[model samples]
Target: MEKVINETDDKIKQYNVCVSYFDTLQECSFSCCFPVNVKPPVIVSADILKFPRTEYICGENFALDGIEAKVCFSDNEFLLYNYGENEGLFSSDVTTLNKTGNNEVEIKIRNKYNNDGFKYILTVIVKENRLVSIDIGKNNEGDVYFRLGKQYTDKVFFDHFSVTKHFEYNKGMTHDIKNNVVFNFEKLQYLGNGSFTGVLYARYTENEKTYYGEYVCDASGNNRIILLTPLPVSLTTEKAESVNISNLAQKLKSANITYKVRYQDNTELTFTGDVFNNNTYSCNGVTYTINCNKNSIWLDWKADKMDCKETSLEAGKLYIEDFWYYGEEDLIKSVDFKNEKTLIFESENIIPEDLSSYFSATVEYITGCKITINGNQLNKSIDKENKLITVSYNGLKFQHSFSYSYSSNGD
Candidate 1:
């Protein structure tokens, strides 16, 4: 009897089998029962004899034809060879060369008889012989842009170019064979993030000496790329503290009290009693007003304003929010001329002092400018590195700082 089985690394599982033999004289069939073993395919040995050359230049074909591998597999045949999370991410395995940055391709072999397979991973890093210059600027549509120069600096030694793009929303596309000086893209993104990246295949030639190659580049906020219009910051209550309306009445100065309330529905209501930001209100967007009227209080609704002597208000969704004019508070972490949302800048010193438990503001420096908190001077030291001026007074901590840079032309 002949035994049939595939050698693999899986736990040995018995596969029942039947074998038959024909008798010439009697013309009858005789059968014998046996067991075969089945498991996952095993990679006995493998050597990548030839792989595509590393650091390929732009505008030049990145040949994958040289990817020759000597793989000893327990499988019936090699089934798949592709690159990236989805195939044809930057360039095709069967058709083109490497266009993106460092990338890898996977080779899979499967045996149909025993249903076993082996996988091999190979890497390729490509580069071009061009200097990369990057900066933050604007695009044609007045949006903030990240500029990546692909042979734009060395335009005199050049010809047409090629580019490749991989986006966060989907697998990227290759924009090869373009006769332009600068390859323009909306944005540049890092891997696994929701953004876009462009690869340039630039060709430079002059005096019978031409340099041909490609390189991948990312914008430098040190891997932090900023966009013109990003999504809004969502409101969260995990860190919120509820507030009481009666506490707001303490800030009033009149016997017949009045208050301007910003309720939870994002609507405003005026009552003659008291109003303050609820401790549980969001810490970033609520506004509070306390007014003592002689006999009537000015009340603001969703759209209209009115005068009221005494009115009862059932508060709903009441919260406190403190924010500058620009945008969210957390995003404006590092206070500078570039990160301001509300306070105005340019030759003016403004103190963002609040009567509440906490206060924030920007401290502009002009070499000899003095800073004071609660009628007292602050420390003489300035953190030039962070461009921030620090101040704390009467149990209140404040970070007030902004550093300025001269215009490119020293304006």
Candidate 2:
């Protein structure tokens, strides 16, 4: 028998044994030495060979490929590589899952002999990107309606859907989805005059995967065409007796006045012209007011008809019967002295103690009489060649003419 073994390094290794015996008489040999203990491989378990799929959606494009890890090693067990196709050994600090809900993803592995590293958390949920909700109704001949589903729940239906015009999605006009609503839907060509926004795009299937939501719909339809019957909050003209304060606007344009209206379905329209010519008239949006009366003039025109006596015609009075005036300078209609009627002052102590701030005026009162510039004086410098500045009003008076002169190269 003979045995010998040696060749191993990591510390301790030696083995030699020889034992020989040849039949009965001469021939003997015996040797023994033993020791073999070379360590350097002890990592019994590393985990994860297949386990990575914890729900994902929001912008999903994640990749940790088949996710593999095994490792073992006390004497071999390998299976790494697939951190999404070779990440040296295997690694991941998240490679695209785009945050939505819980999303951890650590996953690492390395032991290229002894670098030793292994971790694995990987939570990943990420959902968001669902948007299917739109519902706005109104139908009883009043049109406008839409519907879609799922968000706060309305039961949800739709194996396929499509609607457009939130901005014309891509080219405009689309529509599909029948029982799930979408009736009438006017607003003409959409864009807003009051409502209607659109854009649905849905699809279905829940746990079998195949979603596609996206709904908007705001300002739901109705550009005004819902009158099943209702338009008469008030309308009823016709009344104009005697009117003639000097032909009150040609007798209210020959007085045609009619109006009528009445609708809740009993239907009856009528709106004659010159409806009192502007004593106020509007119809659908209600305005009316023209029950005229005026007639009885005579401010003065005595041909001796008992010295003139008719009077009742004053609602915005203007009954002139031969008048004449040229007095208070015709009530003065122009006088705008907003400063400078002649002012030259090179600092006479910076003159202007408040001569009404250099005499102001601006009066333009005619028939609405309001004449101003009440009194502003500073005319007391009689010796330095009269430097007046008076202003007064009502009994009218004006004068500004200043002069100070005191230059020292501050020109």
Candidate 3:
């Protein structure tokens, strides 16, 4: 009987039998039983690698994700490091890799039945670290952001070259490249909140052959690129403030209100306001005033303003143009002239004295003369005399010693 069972088992194995049923075969014709064949599990090919091998720093985050295979890494074999589950994907944050020599990233995977499928071996080529220029936040937590701002200073860099690269990292994660240059400025403590509102300035000195960069800020709480034209060029804010022209209601049309533009390098553009649609705007190719139902924000002229002969600007585009002005016929209580040709006008805001608010008029004759306002203290003597004017500011007394000249010169 034992010999018969052995013969049956052999026959079953040879025929690739699916089941063993001894009752189906007679003792004389009995054969062996065999199990069905099982196939080997499938293995997925996964890898780990660095992006740009040559960079300035090493401690910076090295991020990893979107891995479709089970993976693990270790400095030693006794302690096994598992990264993904059976038939799962994995990733990693910034971690130290082998600085020199060959570093390997090992991986193992299992199939549906949890059977070992295959193990993969990967190599990471770690290169020596180098020092390059960085202009954004520190690389501690690995995440950072930056924005354009207005800042004028001499400390940030060389006299001619400036840095403008903004970067952020966290757990070694990288951006989608499109938004790489843009970063949030609030989180970086080294780059103060105020600096984000300043411009990213750079200067490259030909003599020194060095590049320097800094952030510049405007007085009106905005950070803009120092020389680079802002992206999207212009932005229109909903009018939230009322523009009251009733004060100059009398001098509306007959005498053009002087328009003054303050530009880079202390350059100024002066023109007169032209009234249209109950709003007054300067005539220079760069500025205009718009009156909306609710609010009004300054809209800059587009880049094509010089080529296009239209005073009307696009509805919601951003451009840098003139906004402020001074007129030739506007009443002046005081006027003073300096060697550089300074002429001060007299105007006061409607604020109480205790409020620490003082107003003075500035007369700008585009590329001509800029009058730096000293003070606007009520000149009772000038008001009484109707011609003589006197003003005081910070212990400096200035009197009006000039007359109003309105020669349009065919203007």
Candidate 4:
């Protein structure tokens, strides 16, 4: 009897055979049954002879080297999966170690016949390479700034620079590449005297490889201590009185008003300039208000005067030359005036102190004419409501009704 068995698919099989003799007369036959068992191939042992180095620097390129893998089958047949170098049977999740600290790389190998895979975990210790140094400096504005040292500037390309310590001041530090090629800390206004110590971090590229580095920056000395305070004494000048209106701009350029600023070192620095806005001078982020005395230049000009025609002064026959107030003239123009039917003027509730200034007006007209409020004199009708101010001159009458309120505030 002959039979064929497939070793890969069939594990076991059974067969029966019979033999016959004396074919003509009395036929006798003997039968026997037998079974066959087939052993399937299985992986008995698999191992790696050598692995790549488990340590590397950050951003350093590396590949699998001197790695060899072999597998032993159940039939005692040994197959070389990888020898000397990678034979396309070995693969890894990481080609180069780019992350710092412990980076887990999974190396895998699979048997082609059974589709079984094996994994090896490799922890690569990637250390950071410190290649640059930082130092403290100042800009043209005398503001504290930081930059990479001159010795390393040409060797490395700056990617990002930041302050790692002093989180309160770190938020104010900014990196500007165009005009200011440094980390500017001028916006941190509250930094006081003494040694300012902080960690400076940088990420740069060198020779087509990325690197990270840190530096401890300590800034000291008188120039590093930024202290500014506006002195209590006011600054004034009488130059505005003699200068004409057209030459005021030229006069102000030459006018030098000196002021004192106290620093942390108990030393006062005198700064002289005429750049005053509304009797105020601002320098180094500090604003100082110049107190204008009787002889001061700002008090000589009647800049606070407003024209009566610009306001809601709708009176007939009575001529209003000018109107003056101590505060902003724009506040007077903000009042809503309605000319419908009655020529009424409405205003917000003015405080007690501002009422006297708001009511100041200069009037001119014919003889025997006076300004009255609610049929009484302007000074005596202070407590009356629906106040009406009227001026009558030679039978020509001028009247205006005001609709407004005020808060006395216990006055």
Models 1 onward score TM values of 0.20, 0.24, 0.22, 0.28
- Candidate 3: tens digits of C-alpha lDDT, residues 290-402: 42221222333432121112244322323222223322222223344322222223332221232112325344432234456534332312332333233433233433332
Q: Identify the runs in model 3 with alpha carbons over 4 angstroms from their true place.
A: 1-102, 115-117, 127-131, 136-211, 217-411
Which is better, 1 or 2, measured by lDDT?
Answer: 2
Model 1, range 108-148, lDDT digits (tens) per residue?
43332343444556666545434322222221221122222
lDDT of 4 at 33: 49
Evaluated against the true structure, the overall lDDT of model 2 is 0.43
Model 2: residue 114 alpha-carbon error in angstroms: 8.1
lDDT of 4: 0.40
Q: Relative to the unseen true structure, what is the Cα RMSD of model 1?
A: 28.3
Worst 10 residues of 4 by lDDT: 313-322
Candidate 2 vs. true structure, TM-score? 0.24
Q: Name the lDDT value of residue 38 in candidate 1.
A: 73
Better of 3 and 4 by lDDT: 4
Clashing residue pair totals per candidate (backbone < 3 A)? 26, 2, 50, 0
Worst 10 residues of 2 by lDDT: 299-308
Deviation from native of the Cα of residue 114 in model 1, angstroms: 7.3
Q: Model 2 over residues 1-411: C-alpha lDDT tens digits?
A: 354332223434444444554544555544544444444454566878687677776666666667766777666655555566656776678667777989888876766554566777878778765533332322233332232110212222232223321211222322333333422212233432212344444443334544344433335543222211122322343434443223233333344533455443355656653654355544332343444223222111111111001143212221321112223443355555545333555544465455455555655534333444532632223224454433444444433344444456534
